[model samples]
Target: MKSTIAFLLTLTATLLSHLPTPSDAFVYPKTPISNTVWKPEQDVTISWHDDKHAPLLSSSPIFDIFLMTGADDKQKKLATIASNVDGGTTTSVKYHVPHVSPPGQIYFLMFQTKDGSGMAWATRFTITDSEGNPGTLRPVIPEGGTINPGGIGAIISSSAKHRKSSAAAAKPAAAFADRTATAAGAHAPVKAANAPAASVGGGNTQEENVVVGGASSHKESSALKASAGGLMAVAAVVVISGLQFLGF
Candidate 1:
C-alpha cells in the first residue's frame, strides 16, 4: 500500500511539474500604445502587463529594443532605441532613443535579452526629424530636452555584443500582443490570455517571472513545487479513505 501511494504521488508530481509558470503570462503592456513618429533621440517607456514578474531576474536583465527592417525575405536590424535596460529595477523602464538612429518607417518595438530570447510587437509608426509645423512625424523630445550623454555608449556596446552572438540567425519579428495593466497587484497571472509570439529570438517567450527564479532554474523549481503539491494531495486522500474505513 505504501509503495502504491508512493508511485501515485510520484506520477502526480511529474505531471504537475509540466504545468506553466508565471513567466508564461509575462508581457509588455497593451494600453497606451503609441504609433507616433519621432526623432533620433527620444524617450519610450517599456511597460509590461504582468506585474508579479517585474523583479524576478537572475541579474538585472538587459532589454534591447530595436527597429527591424524587412527586405529580400530577410529582416535586417536597424536602429536600437533602448539597450541594457533594467526596467526601472521595478517594472517599467524608461528608454531614451539613441542619436545614431535615423528617420525611417517603424514597424513596432522588438526587444531581446542577453541570451538571445526576445519578443516583438508589430506596430505602424515612423521616425523623422522635421519640425512640428509641416512635419507629419514627432520629435523624440518635443520639448527640445536632452538626455544624459554618459550611458548611451554602454548601452550601444551591449547591443553590439548581442548582435555578434546572434549573427547566425535573426528570426523575423513576431506578433507580440499587448497586455494592459497598471501595477503589481492589478491583474492576476492566469487571467492573461494573450502573449507575444516566441518566433522572434530565443528562450520561452511565455517565460514568466523571477518567481521561479529566472529562466535557467525555472524548470527545476517548478518540479520541486510539483513534488511538494503531489505529496500533500496524496496524503490528504489517504487520510480521508482511512478515516472512512475506520467507521468510528
Candidate 2:
C-alpha cells in the first residue's frame, strides 16, 4: 500500500506537469483600424504586446508596411513602405501618411511583424483628406463622424505575404451579427476549450506558458482540477487496499 501510494503521487505530479504551456511569442494589441478616415500626411500608430523576453528588434529581417485600396483580397497597392524598425510588436510604429495620398473609401493596411515569427497582419480604415473629408462618402459614419461606417474588424496574423482585408465600411461582413465587427474580422476571437495536452519541448511551449496568463486561465484551472481528481482516486484506492489487507 505504501508503494502504491508513492507511485500514485508521482503519477499525479507527472500528469500535472504535462499540462499545456504557452510558448513565448508576440501579439498585436492595437493594430491600425480597418475603417477610419485617416488624414493625409498624418502619423498612424500601431502597437503590440511582447511577452517573450525578445530583445529589441534590429536589422536583418525587413519589416514592410503598405497601404492598399479596395475591399478584401482584391486591394490595389497605393504605397509600399519598407523599414527595419527595431522594436518588437510592443513598440508602436508611427507610419506617416504621404501628403500626396489620394483619398479613398478603402484604405487597407498590410504590415509584416518584425519578429522572426514572420507574422503578417492586415487592417483597414477609411482614407479622408486632411480636413476629414472621405474621398468617397460612406452611408453611415460613427456617431462623431470619425470612426468610419463599420466597427473594427477582427485581428489577423498570417505567414503569407500581401495579405489584405476589406476596405469597405465594416457594415456588410459582420452587419448581420448585430454587434459591429472588430479588428481582424467580424467574428469573435477563438477561445481554446478542451485543448489537448501540449507536447514536451524543454518545458517551453505556447500551451505550457499560457497557464501563466492570457485567455488560457481556464485551461490551467481544468488541469489543476484533473490533477486533484487523480490524487483523490489514488487515495481512495489505497484506502480500499489497506482495508482488504486488514481483512475488513
Clashes of each: 8, 35
Residues 1-248, candidate 1, lDDT per residue (tens digit)? 66655665666554444333444322354421445554434565545543245333434444554444321112234455445545335345555544222233322444445343333333334543322111222212113222100000111322443232232122112211111111222112231133232222211122111111111112223333453355457656765665555552
**Candidate 1 local Cα displacement, residue 160, angstroms:** 24
RMSD of 2: 16.7
lDDT of 2 at 24: 21
| Alpha carbon RMSD to native, model 1 | 18.0
Point to the candidate with the largest TM-score.
2
- Model 2, span 83-183: residue lDDT tens: 44334322556566543223344445433334433333344456554445554433233343222222222212222112332233233522422332123
Which segments of candidate 1 are over 4 A away from where they belong? 1-26, 29-34, 51-62, 71-73, 87-90, 98-105, 132-248
- Indicate the TM-score of model 2: 0.36
TM, every model: 0.33, 0.36
TM-score of 1: 0.33
